[model samples]
Target: MKNIILLVFFVFHISLFGRNLINPLNKSKDKNFSNIGLYIDGGTFGIGYSTFFNIEKYLSSSKSEKIHLFFRGSYGDVRFLGSGSGGGSFFKNTQTIGASITMITGRGNHHFDSSTGLFYRDESILPLLDLGYRYQKLNGGIILKGKIGILGLGFGMGFSF
Candidate 1:
């Protein structure tokens, strides 16, 4: 998982600079905007919302891609599967808070994002990794994300604004 995450990051980093090398004159201007999204995860059967802020411009002007810092919060009632008749079934209300750094690649309305971060759950903080793709119109768009964290492996879809 760590290797895969590193590879994804490497690929996006290369893509970000590769575009600049290809055609410097054709490079687009920086887009700095905040996005808010709601998502549901299969790992914990949780629903969450997140806010992303594009902070690359403030940090540097040389880069052509956007880098975002995001905060997410989620809530869910997770059922313990396979408890059997003797053990019965149990459910827990779970909550999580996370922060991540995301790099955005591609152009126009369609973009790909690679993110890595950390989340707090069940009294412990754990690393979180995700690879996501989004399609945005003027203000908002749809987002699809696959992630691995303390909650395990999960996929989610939501609207981003």
Candidate 2:
């Protein structure tokens, strides 16, 4: 009688498992799709575009997913960059070209942003620092950012993915 009962229990478990009615792991069907995007930024250095890659997954041991890094370069007109422009400017209309590193932290689509780096124009090098807010999509979509720092105010919008 005990043997018959064991066999019946085994068959029931197999039937439920075969139909995916008893999922033990409960893993999602979608993950690690894509993580990259590009956008245009306008500010003290004029208008320019920047591309960013998501590096949080590689650096974090947990799966929380809340950190990002970016590189920036400026082109066009270096408008208000000059001696009295918070150390990042050097005369108006100066062709500005430089790079910066930005770090972002927070949760969901909202985040706190910070950036620092150096750029050169007209044979002079200047530094930059900014702090502001960022709106980033979870999967991939539109992105917006704003900041105020040593280099003045900056704002930009673009897409990600």
Best-fitting candidate, scored by TM-score: 2
Task: Score every model by TM-score.
Answer: 0.47, 0.56
lDDT for position 97 in model 2:
53
**What's the C-alpha lDDT at position 45 in model 1?**
30
**Candidate 1 global TM-score:** 0.47
lDDT (10s digit) by residue, model 1, range 1-161: 44335434643553455322222332445544434455555554343322222111111222444433333433332233532223333422233445555555565666665557765444556676666565543235666556544445556666655
Q: Write the per-residue lDDT of candidate 2 for residues 60-160, one digit (tens) a residue.
A: 11244456554444343345423333554445335555556666777678988877776655467778677999888646778788877765567767776
* Model 1: lDDT of residue 116: 71
Question: How far does residue 122 in candidate 2 sit from its true spot (Å)?
Answer: 1.3
| Model 2 worst lDDT run, 10 consecutive residues | 53-62
TM-score of 2: 0.56
lDDT: which candidate is best? 2
